[model samples]
Target chain A: MAAPASFLFKGKFLPLVLLLPQLIITGVFFFWPAFQAVYQSFLREDAFGLSSQFVGFENFTDVLSDPTWLQSFGRTIFFSTAVAGLALSVALFLAVQADKQIRASTTFKTMLIWPYAVAPAVAAVLWLFMFHPNIGLFGRMLNAAGIPWDYKLNGDQAMLLVIIASAWKQVSYNFIFFLAGLQAIPRSVLEAAAIDGAKPMRRFWTVVFPLLSPTAFFLLVVNLTYAFFDTFGVIHSITQGGPGKATETLIYRVYTDGVMNLNLGTSAAQSVILMIMVIALTMVQFRFIERKVHY
Target chain B: MLEKRSLWPYLWLGIGVLIFAFPIYITVIGSTHDISTIGRGDVPLLPGGHGVENYSAAWAGGAGRFTTTPAAVMLVNSLLMAVLIAAGKIAISLTSAYAVVFFRFPFRMLAFWLIFITLMLPVEVRIIPTFQVMVNLDMTNSMAGLVVPLIASATATLLFRQFFLTIPPEYVEAAKIDGAGPMRFFKDVVLPLSVTNIAALFVILFIYGWNQYLWPLLIVNDRSLETIVVGLTKMIGTGDAQNEWNVIMATAVMALLPPVAVVVLMQRWFIKGLVETEK
Candidate 1:
């Protein structure tokens, strides 16, 4: 909606008073820390933050040049792509199937959507339990089937585990959006396609899929953002970027370097990089994507 | 509407449901079993008789060697944090949205943008500096530290502003005609009319607050103040010997119960809030 007309209220003092609490919190919590992050990214601090010297672009250069950091950057891109692709496809498949049913659709929706309530950490733990080598059901089954599957020791297996856990937690979210988008499509169009002698698959590809592009695109950005930042807990609980740092994504690197390793400058630089990526994503979503979404 | 359908939809949906439900089902069943059964790697698909024993133990006394805080304490901490964040967010957001939509104040757009920008800077992105700020303010290990930083919500404010914009201008006119002051009008009319939106937002925000993992992990170092989500992770140590699988699974079930219950129970409102807020 357009900004409301400035029609009635007169007391500017009262309005400021009303907005005071939010402004204060935003100032202290959001803007201040953000400014500090930008500032700290340029400065190298000793272990205890007692001494600091400005190193313009050095922290950024160090982070970009470091092999582990570069590897994490590549790994994060791969992880986000995999999570987004898997989550979106599975949710779209489920949504299409669920949308076709008349009876018990809400029941299926309820069953599917409750997993959205499961926290990322809890999701990781649940999956970890299912795949724990010593005590897990599937772990034992896999070993019994002559395929050794221990995520604890194997790097590729660890990546797959975290991806599955993260994607599992995100499926419900994408399902709801896809289902809504599918339902919002007009039935008459599909009916007309059938009258034109198009088969189900042909009609879906030519008509339905094109119309769903807007929803699919919107979900692409959201899911990528989720995979980037929100899956920190998933990575944290599952592998902790373990098995020789194979599962370490960019966000986890920020946490480890900042909190555990106490490398403020490097972590702050990473934070700045992440903030830029997110802002760019947000801008792209609002500027280009929202305009293209077909209502 | 145009094509003949068979049992394929049901079959596919059934498979999907089974895939989603299986892990939770296994967790529930595992929680019911004893440590020895799980330890022996003979994971039963059925519920065991030790459900009461395992749940009670995990609830009263924590799970593993690292878990010094009981599930009860973590649950309480989570509940309190969730409720406080939800209520605090609603309160501040409503007032701020009111000011922005109703009053022509200086720096209005600036204020709105400042709050909006916070949406892009999630806690993960600014972990170090934010943590430094918390440490400087001596807010670590406190509930205020856990809740306040997370409460500056752009979504809630935007939702309220959208809702407020839809209120017919006649209502404000009528209130003015009746000599009701701004505060009175807000309290009597706006507050009453916003009940549904508030409830919807509460459902969404409660789940958000309860499900918070990283923020609590970073801010609250006190074991007693641990939220169940983080506590469950802590209970599962890196090694198998240190992890009590049965108890950990029991606590995992406990950890998910409240938020899952809220979503299921308030399914309609939660969905509406979710869809509308994102839009």
Candidate 2:
């Protein structure tokens, strides 16, 4: 029936035809590539992205047993959790404040989030330079305040620097989602709490927060996913997984193996591991966690 | 009481803003200081003459714009790709959404989950194999390389589908009764209501397109095919020659424009659609 169709159709197959292009694109670009990534992980590469040599589960076994690999994985989890938690909380607080409609709120919202537009590469430079021990802005400020701070050498401090930088960039994004969540709360509910002599904080925690669970849950998924994969630029520029791998997350290892070391097979293996973790993480969030998000 | 109670939160936001913006401001100031002075790590109220000098190196650096002006060219190329991506996305999504919600489509639930799974399997997860496919298709550095594969955006499709559901089906029914075909019904009825979603998707896709780095860097080795992001990363990321601090920052500052523009302008529209998404 759609064979001669031109401008319009009511056939059952019409929508499928419309969806065909994107679906094929997805199959070719997304699913097929994913299949290849999984397959390549079990093999070995001689040149960049070229390969042959099936060692069964050898790459997987090696990756799993390696301490550095484990360290990278552990560091990734630690990094992702810290960045997401801090960013979400700080953002939630800002969202609450802005939702109150303060006189200066619009101005603050505009400038505070301006950095979201700044490239992560630029952000890396900004942080590394700002905290540079000798002439960085934070360094000079620390001198003025009589506090000691230097990000170049100390592993713990370097980790803190990346975390803080990551957290700062993400606050604006979370703030947006949280504000939307807050604005969705019915005014009547808040008013009822107010009339019942409930304090402001109580009204928020009791009346508003439950309504915001769905958004919180949505943001948690989005933020965690972002922290896991998208931190590539930040990690590359800020630490390069150094002051001796203190900040090397899984993705860093992927890049190092693939691009730096040219060990594409091992890199593909790491990428596959990352893909599995993220998919598993996202599924858990959607299946178990998201169910608890109340309207 | 509510006003007074929320006061402390406002103060906390102030502190939050200070913490967020301080690093940027510090960088802007730091970029202008001399590299010798920069290496020395001095913070001054005014900048030294290093800003111009640094730009010279970052521009010529192994990753500099001169070495890869094509990447800057790719910025426009990416912008063109983004425009198509956003428009094509809206068109396909709207048609599909209207079909599922207004007219009954067979396998509708299957379609929804299929689309949703794309979000789960993001480009990052599939990038390795996608590269293989791209090579097979002979799309390594062509415009098709950048645009065609990405024309499929699961996020936009899902968002539009969600947004379209919120529209009153009564309008479509009314239009159908008036002898209006689905196309006419969609054009005259549905699109009028999706202004916010379209705008939001445009801004989001534009930023996503602009901010992309790894794919373009990995797949496209020809510098001319690179985007602003790849250009900036190379300009700064190179291990060659003690990096000129001022030039790298200055180049980076210039690179920041497109995403910033999208954020500033479309943020106003984004808030409205954020509610729709939540709903």
Best by TM-score: 1
C-alpha RMSD for every candidate: 1.7, 4.5
Interface RMSD, in order shown: 1.3, 3.9
Candidate 2: list runs displaced more than 4 Å: A1-9, A44-56, A140-153, A186-211, A262-265, A288-295, B5-10, B30-40, B47-78, B98-109, B173-180, B238-241, B273-279
TM-score of 2: 0.84
Give the CAPRI rating of model 1.
medium
Candidate 2 at B7: error in angstroms? 6.6
Candidate 2, residues A132-224: lDDT per residue as tens digits?
665566656875798666555678887988887777777777888787679888888888899999997898889888889877877887788
DockQ score of the complex predicted as candidate 1: 0.77
Give candidate 2's error at residue A43 in angstroms: 3.9
Over the full model, what C-alpha lDDT does candidate 2 score relative to the true structure?
0.70
Stretches off by above 4 angstroms in model 1 are A1-7, A289-295, B63-67, B239-242
What tens digits encode model 1's per-residue C-alpha lDDT throughout A1-295? 3544433556899989998999999999889999999999999988777999999999999999999999999999999999999999999999988888468899999999999999998999999988988888898899999999999899999999999999999999999999999899999998999999999899888998899988898899999999998899888888889988999999999999999999999999999999999999999888854587654
Ten residues in sequence with the least summed lDDT for candidate 1 chain A = A1-10
Clashing pairs in 2: A33-B129, A134-B40, A134-B41, A135-B40, A135-B41, A135-B42, A136-B41, B54-B247, B55-B247, B70-B224
